[model samples]
Target: MELKLPEIPELSRQHRLAAQEQLDRKTKPVGSLGRLEELAVQLCAIQHKVPPDTARKRILVFAADHGITEEKVSAYPREVTAQMLANFAAGGAAINVLARLMGGELFVVDVGVAAEPVVGVKNRKVRWGTRNFAHEPAMTVEETLQALNVGIELAFEAAEDEVDILCLGEMGIGNTTAAAALLCLLTEAREEQVVGRGTGLTDAQLEHKRAIVARAVARHREWVKTPFEALCAVGGLEIAALVGSMIGAAASKIPVIVDGFIVTVAALVAYHLTPKARDALIFAHRSEELGHRYALELLEANPLLDLGMRLGEGSGAALASFLVEAAGRILREMATFAEAGVSEREEQDVT
Candidate 1:
């Protein structure tokens, strides 16, 4: 199948200005809310609503297995991918807990888990798992396009459900290695600059993982000319799906909360594919992963939280959704100075 990327329209400047004006008139001092105020304006602009409806939040966790585990890159075994999907279905994972606490619905899609389909999870498996990229391309162009379509289908389903905001997450063992390779290729960063201890690899293991990423990139760099080709070269199924999800969400005009390093790598691909997708993305946090900083820098994104979080599965995004909702509520519910009958600052008192 030909992977035709959806066209994401640019966010409206008028809506941004209107939201900023409303925020300035709020009872609090101008910009006192800091990033929260900016988030409100962004939400308003994306949704074209004065206060942006954040009533329905959905977290989509794409699960897959990475054949790179054959390289011993991750501290966890490949079986953990399927195990985590079952855990998510059992409502025992960190994301499940956060989604429940934050009133956000959690859905898991088995894009390529290398196992039988787990009950209670959406089955959209493109393959058993991505091929090991250390010696070969991770996925064929057709498989990559199929994975992307799966994500696009899910995003449209969320739109059908009237979800106001979407959060992107993933559960794929050894995916960090895939993400690191893709990051190195996309950002032209050295292996050390983009490789990190995934699932707590020791210093020596981390070094070995870096070498593997270096080798993989060296093998594929010459032919990986475009973002799509880069994904096919070194990206995992879940990563490609997340890329599609961002594009589809942007096309649907629904803001997406991007999770950590792996998800951020997917965001980088989506941004390169369609720069306007950045307007529909809300970065959730800065992961402890070393490569996350490079991905964030590449996208010029300032995430909402930075509590040294590296746990994927949308945990960071789930926490950040509360802030997104709070920003919307602040714009919708907070009383303006005039409505509250409060005195404004003196015209000469700029400070």
Candidate 2:
């Protein structure tokens, strides 16, 4: 299938200016809210309004299996990917608990589990699992496009449901290896700079993991001509879908709260694919994963929190949704200086 991506417009400077002006006039000292004020302004710019409504939030967790797990990069077995999809459908996963507490609906999407079908999961599998990149490319260009279009369709579906905020998460064993490889390919960084001990690997396992990434990068060095091409070479199916989801959300004017390292890899793909998508993304938190900070720095993203978290499954994003809501409420409900009948400081001229 030929994929046509939605066109994401640039952030509205006019709305950003309006949000800032309103925030300054609130019943507080100028710039008192600090990052919260910045968050509000960015939300306004993304939504093309002074105060962007953040009421209806949705979290989509894309679950798949990576053939690279055959390389023993991750401590967990690839079977866990399909098992966790069942856990998600049963509302027993960490994302499930957090999403319920945060009052956001969670959806488990099976992009490529490489296992038996799980009941109650959205089945959009492109393949059983991606090919092992150590031996060959992870996926073909055609399969990559199919996975991406599934994400595009999901984004439009969320828009139709009136979702105002979207949070992205992923599940796949050895995905950290895939994410690390992608970071190296996209940033031309050394494997040491991007590889990390995923799932509590010992020192020896970490080294072995780095070696696998290096081998994959060396094999596909010539084929990685574009972000999508890089994804096809070393990325997971869920990661490609995430790239499409981010693009679609930006096009639909919905704010996207990105989770940890794996999700940031996808965010990098989307940002590289369309620079305008950055305006619609809200980096939820910094992950403890090895290359997460490097990826965020590449995007110039200032996340809302950092709690030494390395867990994926959108757990961080679900917790950070409250902060986004708080920012919106501050913009909409806080009283103006005049409304509060408060005394104002006299304007002083610098000139």
Lowest lDDT block of 10, candidate 2: 1-10
TM-scores of all candidate predictions against the true structure: 0.97, 0.97
**154-260, model 1: which lDDT tens digit per residue?**
99899899999999999999999999999888876999988999899999999999999999999999888898999999999999899999989999889999999
- Candidate-wise lDDT, in order: 0.93, 0.91
- TM-score of candidate 2 versus the correct structure, residues matched by position: 0.97
Using lDDT as the measure, which candidate wins?
1
- Model 1 backbone overlap count: 0
Clashing pairs in 1: none
What are the runs in model 1 whose C-alpha is more than 4 Å off? 348-351
> Where does candidate 2 clash, by residue pair?
none
